[model samples]
Target: MGEGIPMTNSTDVRQADAAHGREMDPRLFREVMGGFASGIVVVAGMVADEPVGLTCQSFTSLSMDPPLIAFCPALSSVTWRRIRPTGAFCVNVLAAEQRDVSGLFGQRRDDKFEQVPWRRGVSGAPLLDGAAAHIECEIAEIHPGGDHEIVVGRVVALTGDAERMPLLYHRGRYGVLAP
Candidate 1:
């Protein structure tokens, strides 16, 4: 029931059949979406006494009544593979000073936690130190997205520091809030 309207200079609307039924190029889609600024977070979990985590940009609070949050993980993420079986995860909301932490978790490496400082949360997931905040959760639901999985988590704990500035990403670069 949704179709694009003609661009009559009234507002910026493109036709649904733009480029004659050809799908949007992946590169262009990525470039367009990169214009959107997003906060960075690390979704961490414990696996056999080992900590596993991955950087996620797509995370949001889903509900207030039930206290739910959601994060998207790529289909091929090895960290997600390990986290899914644990039944619990912690979201470490990165502070502006944690760009190095985000870069570490965003990669594929066996010693991801070698230099990281963390402690176990009630959910058994590693809670990164120096984060702006932390949300401890238990897995509640899993849904499929085009190239990622939508993981819904039921919030079990919440903690934050208002003085810390959040780390943000936009156009392939890290940013901080304006003063």
Candidate 2:
């Protein structure tokens, strides 16, 4: 357990001025973002004695001094609704061979954890087995995005395995780094 961030009513929507007047097609935006490779993670948390999580690729380290990390989850995420009250979560950095795990959590099924192996972390979050690394964190802040919410977490505990190879996603496929 670590310091928890206070939950807001979510009525205050953060808006910003448009970057440019040029309009871009939604499909082209998705295609451009897909071309950029990113690491994937399964952000899991336990609430009411149940595991809740969803596959995430829009996660990244935000700060080092405060030990913060950020992940973007869709505004209508069912899994987020289930775990929001917990105020804590674990980021399981997927290894190269955990493609099946990714597929299992990518769906909107309630029994997502039925076959997954994991244990609770220090922050009461579920740490997935065989993950390349684990980062336990407390919810710090949340900002409203276009269609997703940017969740910032303050890291409490973390560990990694140097031998494990991370999985990457690019252009709609999973891949491993070349030797």
Candidate 3:
């Protein structure tokens, strides 16, 4: 066999001449990012008094003093467009057993809440039942991100069961923490 080419480090790879530089493929980027485990959440709100929601894995706690949280929604999300006008939402931190719930909301369906049980929270957003935690908030600010919107929420109410295990997503699949 012929001699193999030398392996290049990240710095060298990144600094390669434009014509010879390697660009990240979207599919590979997604696959690499999928290695990171993230808690699953359902971001829900009422649009014209109708419940609208979408499954999300980009939720995060931003600050303690101000009680701010954030989640990224794809720019093309119709549910997000509907919820944006409401100016409020509820983040339902899914429990380990709520994989079906996440799948339901993740799909393109109008009657997502037909079989799902939920109740209106302080902000009038639908707080899903059996969630590990619920965070009700009013939209604080929305910043533009690449192909997504970074929505910040100012927390108004919060409740949850600490004993329950959170639903997790990794490598394009649902997972739960091992004891």
Best by lDDT: 3
Please write out the lDDT profile of model 2 over residues 45-149, one tens digit for every residue: 998988989999999999999999999999888898777778999999999999999999889898878788898898989999999999999999999999999
Candidates 2 and 3 compared: the better one by TM-score is 3
Q: Each model's RMSD to truth, in Å?
A: 3.9, 10.5, 5.6
lDDT of 3: 0.91
Query: Residues 80-102, candidate 3, lDDT per residue (tens digit)?
Result: 99999889999999999999999
* Span of 10 residues, lowest total lDDT, candidate 2: 10-19
- For model 1, which pairs clash? none
Candidate 3 least-lDDT 10 residues: 10-19
Candidate 3, residue 28: lDDT: 46
Model 2: lDDT of residue 170: 99
* Superior by TM-score: candidate 1 or candidate 2: 1
TM-score of 3: 0.88
Residues 16-104, model 1: lDDT tens digits? 33456755556656766787899999999999989999999999999998999999999999899998988999999999999999999
Task: Report how far residue 80 has shifted in candidate 1, in Å.
Answer: 0.3
Better lDDT candidate (1, 2)? 1
Error of 2 at 90 (Å): 0.4
